[model samples]
Target: MTDNQGAWTLGCYGNPDIRTPNINQMAAEGIRFTHALSSNPVCSPTRATFLTGLIPSQHGVHSFLDPKYMMGPEAYNTLQEFTSLGEVLHAAGYTCGLSGKWHLGANMTPSEGFTTWTTKPDGSTQEFYDQKVIENGQMRVEAGYTTDFWTRKGIEFIQACKERPFFLFLAYNGPYSLGKLMLNEARNRHAAFYADKPLHSFPRDAMHPWQHDNKAFHNTDAARRRMASEVSGVDDGVGEILTALKANGLDDNTLVVYASDQGWMGGQNGMWGMGDHFRPIGAHELMMQIPFIFRQPGAIPPGQTCDALVSNYDFMPSVLAHLGLGDKMPQQPKSPGRDFSPALRGQPLAGWDNTVFYEMETTRAIRTERWKYVARIPSGPTELYDMQADPQERFNLFGQPGTEETTTDLSKELEAFFDEYADPKYDIWHGGGSKAKRHAP
Candidate 1:
């Protein structure tokens, strides 16, 4: 999984410029979901949901973890209280390994039942070269590019454990596509390819009114090139990993799930970064929609695209069901995700609700087939968008004459859903604290 990327950044997703042929090939040879979205719009929270199948409220991680609390005396595993994908798989007799960006905290040592861990010291990246990484409980700066290091480590782990059933969380931190780190010229091999071309894929529109972060780099040519370069670099890594899998004769049976932790906006809606870059925080489609592809050669049908609404929250349940480990799914703190494995095999999902919910701190949203309702805790600034007519979210229909009924219905459903799943101790709407840094107003 990539740090910050949009499905629109790949050629298979209709991106005209970005060089992501390897990922595009995965789309061509697998089941791609057009409406798969992240449950949260930020990094750490979404990653947490992807691993545990829990929302931010239930898991207690509402924002990106602070670096100061990631290691040394203060360091603690954020997901210690709950069971994660690695732990579940490990218990099912699979050797689990993580190759990059284990940003859930306690970075200095392996946590969550992962036997082989080589990860970054923190979540954010300032440089791709000579960066600090923690491997086998030791921290050191890598001499080569960070993306390649992770890729190489992932291949090595697969090779070493191919004799047994193994699960590799090959998390790539590249194509981060935000922060001060992107202002510098990309040092990867793909840098030269994008240096000359005008990357029209990254819109250079006027900044949005709510965009309060990463203002300096918005609409700049250097930043655009850097984003494209990093994305292509990740694509290169994907190619290498795929080749390694086939070379080891694990390609046919191994399920290759390609996805990003969350979505990123590169000047979309005139916003430069994610939902947190805004004052009230935005849940625009670009910030929520992600590339979700699954390939297992014989299991999933090739070249099939499903528009059934799905979220990162559903990933754990779906994978568990796919692996025939449905009986092993956590029951204590029930995950809201439903099994969408039927869709993977080109079969219709019976009783599947075509709706997905999103939460980021005080902001919460519900999206159905035709409408999107966004509600904020405490007082005001709620929004309702007619997704069918205005998918770009150009106008807010909240309190508008004809939208009142739709808004009210959506609001009630949103409330009821959260009421069922949200843990009161971590639900911001109920005055609860988050595990990570809170962005509540």
Candidate 2:
């Protein structure tokens, strides 16, 4: 996954501005989810949701794992609460290796059934190339471009386990940094690619909450260029991995899936670098909606696109079905996500709901194909937008005479959807008012 990244508005999805040949090639050779969303719009929470087919509330990874959010090692619930992709697949005899960005805590040691583990500490980047990675619980600084390094490790794992099925969670830490600084090698290659590109024009009332976070905060011309450069570096890494897959004759058999954690606010809404859940910006569609591509050669049809709504949580169940281990998942509460395999096959499953739900901290929002409603607790300054018209969410139509019925209905659905989790804290209406303090497990 391209952690802290976006693919929707990129050249791969529709935008012709950005050049991502490898990402575009992946889509051309496989299926792309047009309406895919990160369950939670933060790194760790969304990553946790990717591993466990549950939202942040269920998985107990409410935000990025760090001192600002979690207190200690025991605070992370990745091990105790839900089944992880690694655990389930590893148990099923599939070799599972996680190479980068284990933001769910316990970074040094293997957890969640990953026998082959390597990652760095939370929120520490000693520069993109020179960052320290913990390999098999051993700490060492890795040299060279980080994006390339992870891909190299991924190739090694693939080569080592060529005789068997393996799940390689290659989370690229590039294309997501928060500053103009980049590894010299990566910067040299990408520094001038976007020199002629224009700066993003922001909305008049756009939310620019932080000025110091320049990398993505204001998204100046320099920032955008750097962001694009980083993306190119990641693209090169992907191309390398793809090359290795083909060279090892694992291209057709291996389902190469690529996605990212969440979209950054790079110059959008006059904000940069912050995820949508950050205050004032609320849960914007740009922040939650991410680029999701799945490539399986003859398995998944090529050059196809699925617009049906899917989330990071849907990946686990889908993978289970793909591996013929669907029934192995312990029966618990009904899963929040559907097996989108049908969508991948261009077969529309029954009851295809194209609605999207988003939540972070005290904010909750529901977005339909044409409309979106955002409310933040007791006093949120509710927001409603006709997405068909105000795709940018520039205009708010909440409390307007014509929106009363739709607003009421969507509000109820949003509240009920949250209530289905059985956790009052996320109920959107009653959760915050519960007698017991609302804290994730």
Candidate 3:
């Protein structure tokens, strides 16, 4: 999994300029999901959902975890109360390992049943080269690039655990183009190739009116090149991972999933970063859509693309069912995810729901096949868009003549869904607190 990368940045996703041969090939050799979305739009909350199959309200992580509480004395495991993907897989006799960002908290040591851990000490990245990493329960500044470091550790874990059933969460913290890191040109191996390229993939639109962060580097040439270089760097790591799997003779049996924790915006709709970059914490399509690819020879058919609407919360359940561990899914908390394992095997889902939802602190949204509704807690700036007629979302239909019924229906559905799944202790709409920091109004 990658950090802050949208599917739009890859070649298979229709970016003509970016060199993502490995990822594109992976999509060709497996199942690619065109409508895979993140339940939340930040790092920690969405990562929690991906692992626990629970939304922010159920998992209690509303936003990116603070560095102070991620390590040191205050550090605590954020997902301790839930049965996470690692825990379930480990319980099923799989050797679980994690490499790269563990922004869920307690970065000082492994959590959620992972035995082999190599991760960054903090969630945010100020620099890629020579960053602080925790390996073997010891902190040290890695001499090489952090992306490569994670990839090497992942490959090593694979080689070491190849004899047994293993589950390696190779989380890459790359293409994170939102902070001081974007101010400087990329210094990785892909730097020279991107230095002069226009990289039209990253838009140079006027700044979004609600954009409040990373203002200076929003549309700069240097930022675009840096973003492109980092994406290509991640692509290089993907190539290495695939080669290692094949070289170790573990490609056919192992299920390799390529995805991002959440989506990112590269000047889309004039927005420059993630959902939190907007003042009201937007839930635009570009901020929710992520690249989701699943590969396993003789299991999932190759060159198939599924456009079924799915969310990150659906991942854990699907993988568990696919691995014949459907009986192990947590039943007490009742995860709001359905098993999409049929779609993974290139089979048609008879009654797959065509809807997904999102939440970011005070903001909540519901998206269907033809419409999108965004609502804020205890306020009046709700929005309704006819996605089929206005895909750009340039016009608002809320309070308009023909949209009242649609708006009412969607609003009630959104509330009902959350009311059924949200834990009252962590439900922000009910005046509950979050485990991590929040961007609440």
**Reference-based lDDT, each prediction:** 0.91, 0.70, 0.91
Q: For model 1, how does the per-residue alpha-carbon lDDT over 198-259 read when each residue is reduced to its tens digit?
A: 88888878889988888987789888899899999999999999999999999988999999
Cα lDDT of candidate 2 equals 0.70
Model 3 over residues 1-441: C-alpha lDDT tens digits? 999999999999999888999999999999999999998889999999999889999989999998878988888999998889999999999999999998988998888989999998888888899889999999999989998999999999999999999999999888888788897989998899988998888877888798888898877888888888999999999999999999999999989999999998888778888889888788888889999999999999999999999999999999999999998998868899999999888889889899999998899999999999999978847889998899778788999998888999999999999999999999999998899877757
Cα deviation at 358, candidate 2, in Å, is 1.3
Error of 2 at 236 (Å): 0.9
Residue 244 of model 2 has an lDDT of 91
Question: Distance from true position, residue 43, model 2, in Å?
Answer: 0.7
Stretches off by above 4 angstroms in model 1 are none
Candidate 3 local Cα displacement, residue 200, angstroms: 1.4
lDDT by residue (tens digit), candidate 2, 1-441: 886676643677766656688888988998888888776667776787777777655555565665422224443434455677888888988899887777676566777877787666664344677677777667888876777778888888989999998989998876774644632333547666667777343222344543333433353455566667777778888888899999999898988888888876565666555443344534777778788898988788898998887778788888788668887664454557668787666677678788867766566778888888887766776889998999877778998888899999999998887778635443324543322123321
Residue pairs in collision within model 2: 216-272, 216-273, 217-272, 424-431
Q: Any runs in candidate 3 off by more than 4 Å, and if so which?
A: none
Candidate 3 has what TM-score?
0.99
What is the TM-score of each predicted model, taking all chains together? 0.99, 0.89, 0.99
Which regions of candidate 2 are displaced past 4 Å? Answer: 67-77, 124-126, 179-188, 199-219, 422-441
